[model samples]
Target: MPELKGVDGLSEPLLRLYSSLAGENPWVEFLTVLRRQLHASFATIILTPPTARTPAIVVTPGVPDFEIGAAVKHFSKDPFVGLPEGRVLTANEFVGREAYRQSCFYQQYVASYGIEDIMGLDLLAKSGFQMRMRICCGAGRSGFTEEDKQWLGYFVPHLRAALDLYERFEIEKGEENIYDTAVEQLSVGSILLDGSGAVIRCNLIARNLLEQRDGIRLVNNRLAFSDTANERSFRDFLRASGPALTSRISFMQAERHSGKPSLGIIARRLTMPPSLKLGFCPAIAVFITDPQQQAGVTGAAVANVLRLTPMEAEIAASLANGLSLLQISEVFGITQNTVRAHLRSVFSKVGVSRQSQLVQRVRTSVSGLIVQMSSGSGAPRRRSRQGAPLLHSAGAGQDRPQVKQTRRLSHVP
Candidate 1:
């Protein structure tokens, strides 16, 4: 790569671009700064090539939305198509100035947009994905020179690396969203905690549980039990489950107000996946199950898993929640006989005979096993029907466990 004079001026903008691509700032702002640094009238970064099926992602700051739309719609007419990848090409190289002025592409698209001189560099192309950077000078400005091309060449590698990093970051974000959505759909409340017992990330159910303050709640962004004794024990348990050392899964019971059933909590240590080592993912996954709350599973999941009708799935879900025939009838606004008829069909499809059997089967089959309360100890026990326990034992409690720890163990600051 040819070194450009006064390259120090590009350092700040390059750093900003890297940060923006990493998702810290807006990407358009970086593009605007980049266009100014190159002294171009307009600049664009296209992620996808102009094709019939896939729409290209053209990022051009300081350009009107209507012009952007027009450019994308007529992108196939772009003069830079089929150019050598990773090589900078000037408009004049493709066609003589007089010939280009008379071409349909120039008359219909380029002239209307006031674009006079164009220069583009293909940044990357792999598989079906392609990315390119283009800079255009208006009618008033002169065409890009050899010095301009050399300056852009010096930063091509940096732009490529930044784009790759941004792509990975987007993929990770998408995966995180899917994981969060799945967890939120479950009947169980999921809370992700860091090494310091502080709440890192949580789903909708967990947020609702915290807001309700039934048994567990958030105190200064840290997980806290309503009961002082239970809170102390829980804090100690979290402290012992640091990332440096692997610890056994722990179970704790939170006492609720009134005569309602106590909340069941199952905590297990989780190691950050190698791909997410640079992000803030919790080291501990805590599942909370309230006995008073009904088992809620999506009707679609039940239908797909058991191959039952929509009505049958709804009836089965009601049965799984320990609802009686009369209660199901009242809830569905149907007669008791109609309820029994649906129940029979549900039982036949689910391979169960009695209501108790149907409840047990649906509870275990559709939503996995429930956390049953242990007889001797008040702690909740995770019992999977497949004989694979969801959580391990917490081992013996320590007399004096350290509480304070780092918020993020593996994340890059």
Candidate 2:
């Protein structure tokens, strides 16, 4: 191998390629851009495992259309795949040393894959991470020059950023899809409202529920759920629950005009997943209403879902109904200071910031559990169902306190 020169000629195109990849999918754009710029026969993007032995091509496009999975499977045989993991196996080094290089892995697996000389860029994610990215460009009629490698290398970092964004977008999109499916499968009418109380998203059930009458029609920027005290309560709940740390509030009303007799409001805060705490995305507030089946988990049900102590569950249920600290304290016949202390413990155990966040988390978690149950995956859990006593001896609504018999319903004897 000769001494590699600086990337003087390729800098301009490389910069343009980088700019194009920003806020866009890298692999698709790379194949399209490289085909015209590098004039390559084929281009592929491969993801290599930590060991760098298995190069799974996540995306491939360009000339010499190949079997996507099989092409990547074959490339895993090449020892050069490990180069990104700090193992440098160059073409010059492998060609003369390894006899297998004589028969290209692609040729052995799929003849006429038409890969002659290849230029690759080794890409790794965050520092100290084990994943690798390989960009392979094959020579159709004529082989690649050293210049092609320098050009591709110049654009590799930009492509890597785009790939990372694309992967995240896909993940969030998939999660949203699952959420939508869950909402649709159930009889619950679910709606997710933004901080401003605008409907960001609502399922089919919510649509039918709200659109049946003109009472809750979507005006320019507001929702008119009802004309009486129900609308005012809904507004109050949304305002209080919008920024709650470990609490949520929700509203439900029977379609009186539609001949159903259900009307209620519940509010709770949403919890950010521990994994997503690294970013600054806003916490979500979920709203759901139903006339037939009551909305929200019963006190016993929520206690089971969160594995909360009976006292904690009572506090949570109170907060979920949009009760202030003073209100909750009065309701439970406890001092305000005691209510504050209990809430702190609730936030810590449930992993949320304020009351609103907690309520949102509880609703989302319970809804998810219900969805899983409907799919035959499992059942909703309650503290009482967890072989724990349902109530404390000192709290309101106390019962005769004997050692309650317990049974484990999760795994039967």
Candidate 3:
């Protein structure tokens, strides 16, 4: 541990700070710790400036959040705009003590939130990236003293380094996400099974398919089929035998009240390398592809692109699949009014005015690309939910020309 000589109660916060980059609510834990230590109203991060298209991302735990801290972005009249970069400054230091108290911004905006004083730092990275962090005092909390400023200064270098590391992580993660992005676009239902043939994880496509309760659905978190013989074979394939094997089941999941059941499924036993063999990892992957699903738009496809809520994405995808408003309502078991309301939200977010325009937007999206039918069962499958490599399906002796093993499972009563 580096010497935190001047700063008191900083060791815990700093530990949380560096560890929070990958967490769901990154930095919230650190901010909470720091807020208590500093005896402040809030420790907030202004992640981005609010824009016409999207709202600013604010992280101020235990507050109205975007309303108070994000006010820095919306409020036009701001006297604290020009803080020295990478340096901590108090509100009193920004403007004269008397001027800051008398400023219209404080009276009109700051006072309403019960915030009495603010110690802020603006960090600008080499990539022209910027974020502001403020340690604020509310009513009855004593204003920041000189010791506070000195203590905060101790964190600047560490914070900058953490931010740099965070940016690099995001870049690397973005590159890795291309595989998932492609799978989501293809809309292939993928499920991962363990050594005992129990479902461990599934992608959004699998979730949606399982929801339909078609020929292939989940039974107690494991893959299930309408025919007993197919189910037995699928279970057998999921069990790890001496040699890793792959199989394909055709029309295994027959859609009830549908024109034709053309779902093609591929199951492969996986072999983990000696290094990656740790833990109770998934041992099988079942890749399900429905021509009807792959040929049309799936809700999972556009969810990331539009940043749409799951419901909105579903509604949009349904519309893109040539389903009318009534059809969407009927399929989802919701009222037409509710369906229209969600459609309107989608329209607003996507900048479209009409249903036709919305459908056109979904159809034109890269996610709308049709996934072609693979030549046979041995064809590769896409990535599963946050998994190991899917393309590296070949087990031991991967370079050898293994015999083309195929199991064409047909539905038998």
lDDT of every predicted structure (CA atoms): 0.61, 0.50, 0.63
Best-to-worst TM-score order = 1, 3, 2
Candidate 3: count the clashes. 0
Error (Å) of candidate 2 at residue 218 is 3.6
Model 2 segments more than 4 A misplaced: 1-26, 48-57, 62-66, 72-80, 86-101, 109-111, 126-142, 159-187, 211-222, 233-255, 263-284, 291-413
Q: Is candidate 1 or candidate 3 better by TM-score?
A: 1
Candidate 1 Cα deviation (angstroms), residue 224 = 0.8
Q: All candidates' TM-scores?
A: 0.66, 0.52, 0.56
Candidate 2 lDDT at 305 equals 62
Candidate 2 lDDT over 1-413, as tens digits, reads: 22234342344445444554433444455455565566655455554322223332344443333344454445545544445432323343444323434556533642344445445555555421123433333434445565555555655556666545543443344334444434443356555554556666667766776677534556554566656766776667655632234444344553356556654434444555556534543233444455565454444445656767777877887677577888888888999998888888889999998888988877777677644532324342112323422222111123211111111110000
Q: Residue 83's C-alpha lDDT in candidate 3? A: 86
How far is 308's C-alpha from truth in model 3 (Å)? 17
Candidate number with greatest lDDT: 3
User: In the order shown, what is each candidate's alpha-carbon RMSD?
Assistant: 12.7, 16.8, 14.6
Model 3 scores a TM of 0.56
What clash pairs does model 1 have?
A: none
